[model samples]
Each structure stands twice: as C-alpha cells, then as structure tokens.
Target chain A: DAGVTQSPTHLIKTRGQQVTLRCSPKSGHDTVSWYQQALGQGPQFIFQYYEEEERQRGNFPDRFSGHQFPNYSSELNVNALLLGDSALYLCASSFGVIRLGQFFGPGTRLTVL
Target chain B: AQTVTQSQPEMSVQEAETVTLSCTYDTSESDYYLFWYKQPPSRQMILVIRQEAYKQQNATENRFSVNFQKAAKSFSLKISDSQLGDAAMYFCAYRRRNAGGTSYGKLTFGQGTILTVHP
Candidate 1:
C-alpha cells in the first residue's frame, strides 16, 4: 500500500504570488493534515481536514488555506507568499482519531524568491 | 499554549552506540501524548516512538525507547545500537488529548535535533 504522496516535489514563486501543493493520503485513510517546515526547524501544523471540511487550524494567517476532496486528497494554497513563506510543505494522513498517529509524505520544498 | 523544546540542536555518536535525545514540553492539560519523529534527508517524518501521558510505562519499539516523566514534563528518546541510517533530524511533538478524540488533531512540534552517526 502506498503511503502519503505529495505533488510538485519543489516549487519556486515570488512574493505576492500564490502556490498550491497537492497531497494524496494513504489508502484507507480519510483525514489529511498539512504542515510547514522551515529550514532547520521541525514541522508546524497548518490545518487538518476530515470529511472534506476543515476540522482544525493552527496559528497561521488567512493567506494559508487548504481543501480536502472526497477522495481524501488535499491541497494547501498559500496566497501572498512572502520570503518567510518558503519552507517544506508536508502532508500527513491519519485514521479517525489522533491517537493513531499521523503518516507523513516526502513534502514539497517551496522557495519564494 | 503548548510548547515543545528540544535543547540539543545537534548530536554525534558512533555506530553501535546508544544516544539519547532530550525533549521537554509544557502543557496545562494533564492528558496528552508525546512523540518522537525522525526526518531523514528524504524529508519524510517517520514515527520513532510515542508515549501517552497517562501511561506510566515507558514505550519501547525495538531498538528505540522513550523515557516519559509526567511530573517533569520530559520525554526523551534513546536509540540503541545506532546505525548510520539513524543520522537525521529528530523532532519532539506534543498533541493534546481531546475527550472527544476527534477534535484538535493537530500536533505541536519542537525545533528538531540533527543526529549524526559515525562509522
């Protein structure tokens, strides 16, 4: 069975531009969560989606949003990207509960130039 | 607010040796979970081991184990018989245990510690 998969292994954008990163959850999983990992730092929670609706969010601003499809895949969209927005975007999927732990993807490296 | 802290920014050890990575967290909630995740150059976060705050027994996973001290709010991971493959960034994370079990699934992570294993 495949684990979580993310598209666009790398991305380059400019300030004020928008970028969308995609992710497909592992088979048999229904929830998807996104994280941002700045250079040399651990991953920070962005938001989580279950049943196609956002169930929880982090301290991020409105410029960062996400969507979850019926298939359980997810998209993280960052608008008005700043140089600080450049980071590794990770996608994780879990079962119904958080205790099950989360399985993460390889993550997409975003560089805002 | 919950916060996880990994004081060691980097550590080095020889293969076949044991190395312990330190982690400490602060949370007002009594019931929660602590985790150690390994992120290799591949950038995939791999679950090393996890400990539930309510459980007094330290969790053990093969060559990996955790020392979870509830009162001290400390959770440390020890890697035994370390291998070159163990060289990577290790992260400490905390997740609040919601009574509903469905809400607040987000994880708060600490700054990672880069581990270097020598042959």
Candidate 2:
C-alpha cells in the first residue's frame, strides 16, 4: 500500500515570501496532519484536515493555514515567511479521526534565505 | 495544553548494548496516548512504540519497550540489543483521545533525543 507522500523534496525562499507545501495521505487513509520540525528539534504541530475542512490547529500565527481536498490530499500555506520558518515539514496520515497510529511521510526541507 | 520534554539531547551506546531515552509530559486529560518515533537522516518519522494511558501495563514491541509511570507522567524508551540501524533521533509524542466533536489527531512532541550507536 502507498504511504504518505509530500511534494518538493526541498524549497528555498527569502524573508516575507510565501510558500506552499503539498501532502497526500496514505492510500486508505483520510485524515492528514502537518508538522514543522526545526533543525535539531522535534516536529511541531501545525494543523490537521479532514472531510475537506480544517479540523484543528496549533498555536501558530494567522499566516499559517491549510486545506484538505476531496481526495484526502492536503496543502499547507505560509504567508510572510520569516527566516525562522525554515524547517522540515512533515505530513502524517491515519485511517480515522481517532486512529491510534499515524504514518508519516518524507518531509519537505524548507530553507529560508 | 500538553507538553512533552526530552531532557537528553544526545546519547550514545555500543552496538550490542542498550540505552534509554527519557521523556516527560504534562497533561490534565486522563485519556491520551504516548508514542516514540524514530527519525533517521532520511527525515521520515517512524513509530517505534506507543502506550495508551488507561492501560496500566507498559507497552512493548520486540526489543523496544516503554517504562510508563503514569503518576509521575514519565515515559522512557529502552532499546535493547541496540544495532547500528537503531541510531537515529528519537522523539516522544502525545495525543489526546478525543471522544467527539472535531476529534483532531494532533501530536504534541518533545524536543527530541539523538541516539548514536557505535560499533
């Protein structure tokens, strides 16, 4: 079975620029969560999507937003990016909202120059 | 709000030895789940093991096991018979068991511990 997949192996952006990352959940999964992992640190929750709507969010700024598509794929958008926004972006998927296990994808490495 | 902490930033062990990574969490909710994830240089986060809060018995999987102290809010991962493949950055994560109404599955993660295995 296919696992979670993310687009753009790596990305580079300057300060105040906008960037978007995409993620496709596992073939049989529907829920998708996004995380941001800074260098030498663990992944921080960004937001989660299900049923083509945002289910919950973390303590992130308004500039950070996300969307869930009808196909169970998701996208994370960041506006007015700061240098600190550079990190590895991970997408996790599960079969249901209350599922116990979450499978993660190969994260997209973001570098803010 | 839930917070997970990993005090050890770096640790090393012999290939055949064992090592433990410490993790502590604070949460008011009684129903929740704890997880240990391994992220190698490839950057793919893999679940090592998980423990349910209500389950008194500590969760174990193969050579990977957890010492879960519910009262102290402590969860540590012990990797026995460590191999070179076990060398990676380990993360401790927490998720609340939402009963209903937007039961989003978001994980609260610790800072992380880097494990280095030497031959």
* Chain A TM-score by candidate, in order: 0.97, 0.95
Give the 10-residue window scoring lowest on summed lDDT in candidate 2 chain B. Answer: B97-106
> lDDT (0-100) at residue B15 of candidate 1?
100
For model 2, the local distance difference test gives 0.91
Which residue pairs does candidate 1 place in steric collision? Answer: none
- Candidate 2: segments with Cα more than 4 A from true spot: A97-99, B100-103
What digit string (tens of lDDT, one per residue) describes model 1 on residues B70-109? 9999999999999999999999999998887763488999
* Per-residue lDDT of model 1, residues A21-75, tens digit only: 9999999999899999999988889999999999999989999999999898999
Candidate 2: docking tier: medium
List TM-score per model, in order.
Answer: 0.97, 0.96
Residue B23 in candidate 1 has what lDDT? 96
